[model samples]
Structure formats: structure tokens, C-alpha cells
Target: MKKKRKSLFWKFLDGVEKVGNRMPHPVTIFAILCVIVAVVSHITALTGTTVTYQGVDPKTFKAGEVTVKAVSLLNPEGIRYIFTSAVTNFTSFAPLGTVLVAMLGVGVAEETGLISTSLRKLVLSTPKTLITIVVVFAGVMSNIASDAGYVVLVPLGAIIFASVGRHPIAGLAAAFAGVSGGFSANLMIGTIDPLLAGISTEAAHLFRSDVSVTATSNLYFMIVSTFVITALGAFVTEKIVEPRLGEYKGSHTEIVEDITSDEKRGLKYALIAMILFIIGMVLLTAPANAILRDPKTGDILGHSPFMNSIVLIIALFFLVPGVAYGIGAETIKSDKDIVNGMSKAMSTMGSYLVLAFVASQFVAYFSYTKLGTIIAVKGADALEAAGLKGITLILMFVLLTAFINLFMGSASAKWAIMAPIFVPMFMQAGFAPEFTQVAYRIGDSTTNIISPLMNYFAVIVAFASKYDEDSGIGTLISTMVPYSIIFLIGWSILLIIWYFAGWPIGPGAQIFL
Candidate 1:
């Protein structure tokens, strides 16, 4: 008999797994990248590489051919920066502070059993046929609360799936797909919206000072994408992901314990607190002269305290409900319990802190060297010379962003680097800045599930290990590849349809400048 052969798809997946397994830890990867950036900076400087741009230099008011050259980071000054700025770099890392603050509140809920009981109640109350859809939808919406979704919904999804006798990993995959893969898509404005929009606005200023982008620039498209992700997530889970896993062979220990009366009371208390909180927020922003609205224009979305304090607001949103639940359940009998809950949350972040420190240094060095800007400018110039237009131009940009996203995971950081170059290029090519921003978002979000550089990738792996002790980066990547491919394709098709239809991506946002 002839030897049997595995399918090319399986073989490719195996190769990916092997490659990923052979790769060093993310912290080690950043350390290597730091050295690479330093060396590349010196080499470029030695070669006298520079880029001359036709746009107005933000540092100068004049519009001319401003030359940008790479700064060598291998000199004595560079060596000094490496040692002296280490502390500030780690402390100022954008995700570090946001994540820690958000986790403080989430940690309280998780520690007090509020999250577990609430999720259980939600799953049990939902119709069985809609469980997959609900979990996926919840995951998509969780972005509004920032990183809390990753910590709570991902593992909860696995528990919910296992409780129904399905493969636990499948559920985790679904939630991960929605949380990370659909990161930029949400029914409501999220912290990411303002963050990316601010960067985009700055980039747009390079082309025209009169132009500006709002936080809601992609709101309409993101709302539609939320549904697209929900449907795709459910389909992939039931048809592709779940079927591939076959059956669950793991213990169901992660499932919530039998719902006690005290837990029910806690949930009741949390619900009440959440309802009251929403009402208060509504009062704060819904009426004319609302306290949270912009004092000058009375706008909630622009230059407003509400937008500025969203992270803190989200923290409070979780904290109030959590404390209410804890009190009701007696999990927090004293103020010391609250402190302990917060401490426990911070404790889980030891590994993340180490990774963040190295990653921060890499980001700082990359920014300092001006290498990222030069690459963006050169890349844009090359792309423009290709003479692409319409759908071809849009799709190419999406692919370019997707490829870049594989190496750099922070959406804001990548946008900050690429926007100044591409935003102007797109404008000169007759495309709108918001259109380019949306395409970048599609690319950025789809690849987040696979990128090891993403801040939360390690956490997702930890969640998976709970079900299968042997699960590693390769396992997560292989499982998530289908989602990534589907999301990219489906989302691309939707963009094309919208483009041909000439639909606005958001309020007053068009496809062409």
C-alpha cells in the first residue's frame, strides 16, 4: 500500500505550529528587536538614507521637501538612553496603565464571584439556540469596557460551552475571535475609537490643517461589522471550529458552582447598581447643558471630559457594581477585602509587567530612531508609484496594513507611524482619510488574534492551558487562523460592496476626499 499524505492545509498548519513553537518568548522577541532596531539605525545613518516629503512638516509651518534621516541609536548618547529612560519608558507605556486600572475593577468582580455568577445567570437565561450568538455578541461589545473583555469573557466563553457539552476550546476560540479579531468593531464608541481617531487626526493634519477626524469616524461601519463578526463567529464556532475539535475530553471544573442564594442576591445587587449607573450617565450626557458634554460646543464626542475620562469611567462602572455585589454576597466584609481583591489582580500581571517593560523599550527605541517614519514614507512613495486606483488601491492598502500588523500589534502606535505618510498619499490619490483609517482598522483587528506582539496574547494562552495543559502558541494560532482568514475576506467583501454603493463609512465621512 502507498503511504498516505496529510492535506496541504494540515501540513501548513503543522508548519506554522512548529515555527511558532520554535520562536522565543515575546519578551525575548522584543529584546532581539531592540538590538535589531539599534543596528538598523546605525546602518541607515552610515548609508546616508533619507526621505524628502512634499507635505507640510508639522515641526515647521512650511510645505516643502523636508528631508527625514534615520538617527543612529548605537552612539554613546544612545547607550545612555537605554539605561536612563528604561523606567520612564515602562511607566509611560500606553497599555500598561490602562490595563492595570481596568483590571483593578475587574479583579474585584472576579474575586468577589460577581463575574462568575453574572455570566452563569446570563448563559442559563439565554435561549439555547442563541448561546453561541450571545457569547460572540457579548465578546464584541466587551471592547467598550476595554481589556476587561479579555480577562472575563474569554474564559467565561469556554465555561459556557463546556457546560453545554460542547468543546471548551471552541468556545474560547469564538470569544477570542470576537474580542481580538473583531477588536475595532463595536456597537458603541470605545476607548480605541478616540485613541485611533486622535492619531488619524494628527496624521491628517500633515495633508491639510483644516481637516479633522472625529472619534466616531468609523462608527457606522463598526456597528455593521459588529453584526458581521457575530454571525461569522457563530458560524465558525458551530461549523468549522467546533466540528474540528470533535468533543470535549477535559474536566468541567471551570464551570461555575451551583448558583447559591447569596450569589443570586449579589447579582441582583450588581444589576441594580449597573442600572442606576447607566441612568446617571444618561442624565449626564443626554440633555442640553449636560455636565459631561463639551462646555464650548456642548458635544459629548469631541473635546469633552466624558471622552477624556472614559477609562476612569469604565473603571468606576465595573467597580461600583462589583462592590455592590461583593457587599451583598458578603465576599467583601471589610475595606481590607477590597484592597486584597485589587492586590490579587495586580499579582496576576507579574509576567505581563516583564513583557511590557521590554516591549516599551522596543517601542521607544523604534520611535526615537525615526526608522518607522522613514519606512512609512518610503513605502507610501512606492505604493503611489504603482498607479493603483479605486478598489485596487483600497484593497492594497488593507493588505499592506494587515502585513504590517503582524509585526506591530498596537493599533494606535502603528497608525501614528503610518498615518503621516499614507494619509497624505491617500489624499493626493483622491481617497478620504477616514476611508484609509477604516481599511487600516480592518487589517489591524483581523491580525490581532495571530500576532504574538499583541499585549494580551499571553493571557489568551494562559486561558487555553486551563482546558488543555499542552496547549501552546501554535495551538491558539492554528485554531484562530480560520477566523482571521474569514474575517479578512468577509470584511473586505463588505468594504467593496460599500465602496461600489458609495456609502459613507460614518457620519459625514466619505470614501473620497
Candidate 2:
């Protein structure tokens, strides 16, 4: 008897999954990376490899040429830093606090049946023709509330898809594509906008002290991108990913339907609570003397407490609605249910916590070694020396950024390092800082879905594992590759078109210097 052989595509995917699964857990990989960083720093430092670039002197606040050299972590000072900074590193890891805090509220919503009910209602009510678009668009818009999208929408997409008898993993991929792949594209300004803009401002200051980059610098393009990503995500999910997935035959078949009268009442109460919450937020930020606004400047966007506390605000929005729904439905009879919900959410994060601790150390050590900065500077210098102009140069820069994004997970951190070099260089070549910044953003966002080093990658695998017990990082990445590739091509073409048409990428942000 002859056995059937697998095709090349499946063989390749199998190879990827086998290889990825055979590797150590992400925590162990990070620990290994930390050791590797230490060893590489010694080798580089011993070789006296160095790179110098124009940068702002942190202490002096003046533009000057700064030389970076790899510092070995095998030394006494390095050993001291490793020991003393361990606790701080873990504590300071940004995603840790954000995910944990956000989950505290989401925990209540999920446990009290609010989230499930809401998602079910949304899916059931949406038109069949628009289901894919709605799911993808919701995922894109969810970025406005920060990491809540990852914790809530990704799984919700799966549930919704499965309810409709579609492939759950396909739905998960679509949502993940929009949430992570379209992270930088939103109709509204997100925390990431101001954070990245602040870093861009700092980098731009290296060339011109008076240069400023605002949160809205990328607004118009991002708004257009919101649609671009939504359309692409929906198209890919329907035409490519879903077809590949076919029918889901997994054991997890729980679907929410036929909503009970109590659940209906609960949803009404939740909606009212959410409305009130929004009204409260409006009152806080809509007035000149509002508490959440900037005390000194009376601004809501820049250096404002309102922007800083958006996460907490979102948590309250969720918490309030969950409690309201619970009260209406009598599902949560006591505080113990609320406490249990929060505890359950935290329990699921056990693996994430371990990964975060190790990842934090690796990130800190990499920064300490100055390798990322050197690599970024070197890359930027190479691109600058290429002497290309117009669309050719712009496209090259975008490609370079996309390539670099594979290694660095933090967009702000990577931009902070690259912008000082590229912003100045592009300006010298008669391109606006905003133009270069947008190019970087397109690259940064497109690669996030494919990058295993991304902070949320492990979390995503955990989410997918709920449906397919064998789903691993490779499975997730393979599912996401279509989105990543399409997004990259589509976004890059959009940028080129915007460039050729001589349009403003944002308010007062021109394509040329």
C-alpha cells in the first residue's frame, strides 16, 4: 500500500510548527537571550566595535555626537545591575501592569456574563454580509481602549465565528490581525499615538530644538488606514484564511444563543451604565477646569492626566457595566463572585507572568548593552548613504523599518532609536519628519503580527489554545502571515499613492520638508 504524501505548503507549515514547538518555552528563550546578550556584549566590546551618531545629551539637553560601545554584562558592574535591577525590571515592564489592571475589570464582565451576552447579541444582530467587516472593524476600533482588545476581542471573535458555524481559528486570526496588525491605525487617538509622538519629538529635537511632533501628526493617514486595514482584514479572513481553515471540528462547541429574558434585562442595564460612564468621562475632560485635563495648560491631549488614566477609565467603564448587569440579572449575588472572577483571570496569566519576568530582563539587558541603538544607527546611516530620493528612498526606509521591527518589539523604543537618525537624514533629503514617521509606523505595525518577540505574542497563543489544544506560536504566526503580508503590501502602496498625489498625511504634516 502506498501512503499519501503531504504537499509542500503543509510540509513547510508542519516543519515550522515542529521546530517552534521543540524550542524551549518563551521564558527559557528569553533567559537564553539574556545570556546571549551578555556574551555578545563581551565579544563586541573586546573587538572595540563602536558607532557614533548625533543625539541629544540627556543631562545637557543639547545636540551632540554620542558614541555607543557595547558594554559587557559579564563584568562586576553588569552582574550588579542584573541582580539589583531584576525586581525593578519585572515591576516596570509596561505590559504587565496594563494587562493585569485591565483584566481585573474584564474579569468581572466575563464572569457576570456581560461580555459573552454582549458579544452574542452583537454577532446575532449583525447582518450576515457584514459579519466579517464588523468583527474586523470592531477589532480595529478596540485599540482606542488600549490592551482591552487583546484580552477581549480576540477570543470574542472566535466565539462569534464559532456560533455562526464558521472556523473559530479563522475568526481569531482576523481579530488578531486587526488588533495587533492594525494597532497603529485607529479612527481616534490612542495611548500609543501620544507615546510614539513624544518619542518622535525627542528624536526630532536632536536635529532642531524647536521641532515638535504632536499626537495628531499621523491622524489623517491613520484614519484612512483604519478603513484600509478593516477592508484588507475582512477580505483576507473571508477569501484566504477561512478557506484554508475549512470547518472547525474541535471539541469546544459552546455557543451563546437564544438569550434569556434576564440576560436581555442585564444587557439593557449594562448599556445604561456604560452611557453614564461615558457621560462622566465627558464631564471630566470636556470642561476647561476639568480634573482630568492638564492642570497647567488646560489641555486634554498633551501631558494630561486624562490621557494617562485612559486605561483606568476603561477599566471602570467595564467594571461598572459588569456590576450593573450582574445586579440586574442576579448572576452576581455577592462580592465573592466578583473576587473569584478577578482571581480566575489572574490564574490564566500564570504563564504570562513567567514570560514577562524573563522578557523584562532580556529587554533591560539588551538596552544596557547599547546593541539595539548601534544597530539602528548603523542601519539608518546605510540607508542615508544610499542617496536615493523621492518614492524610491521612502519605500526603502519603510522596508528597513519593517525589517528592524522583527527584532525590536516596542515601537516607541525602536522609533526612539531610529528616528534620531532617520528623521534628521530624511529632513536633509527634503522629506518631512511626519512623512518619515508614518513610513516607520506602517512598517512597525505590519510586522507586529508575525513577530514572536512581540509582548502580546504569548498571550495570543494562550487565547488560541482555548480552541485547539495543540495551537502554538507557529500556528498563530502561520495563521497571521497572510494578514501581515497583505497589510505590508497594501499599506506601502497607500503610502506611495499618498506621496505621488502630494497629499498631507496629517494636519499640517506635509510629505516634504
- Strongest candidate by lDDT: 2
Query: Per model, how many backbone clashes are there?
Result: 0, 0
Q: Considering only N, C-alpha and C atoms within 3 Å, which residue pairs clash in candidate 2?
A: none
- TM-score (C-alpha, index-matched) for candidate 2: 0.91
> What lDDT does candidate 1 reach at residue 352?
72
- C-alpha positional error of residue 461 in candidate 2 after TM-score superposition, expressed in Å: 2.5
Flag regions of model 1 displaced more than 4 Å.
1-5, 54-67, 145-152, 155-159, 162-172, 189-217, 242-252, 256-258, 283-297, 408-434, 458-472, 508-513
Off by over 4 Å in 2: 1-14, 56-63, 194-214
Query: For this target, which candidate reaches the highest TM-score against the unseen true structure?
Result: 2
Worst 10 residues of 2 by lDDT: 1-10
Q: Could you give candidate 1's per-residue lDDT for residues 138-249 as a string of tens digits?
A: 9999888667677667877887887667788888999989999999899999877866776677677777898888888899999999999999989988876776566778
User: RMSD of each candidate?
Assistant: 4.1, 3.2
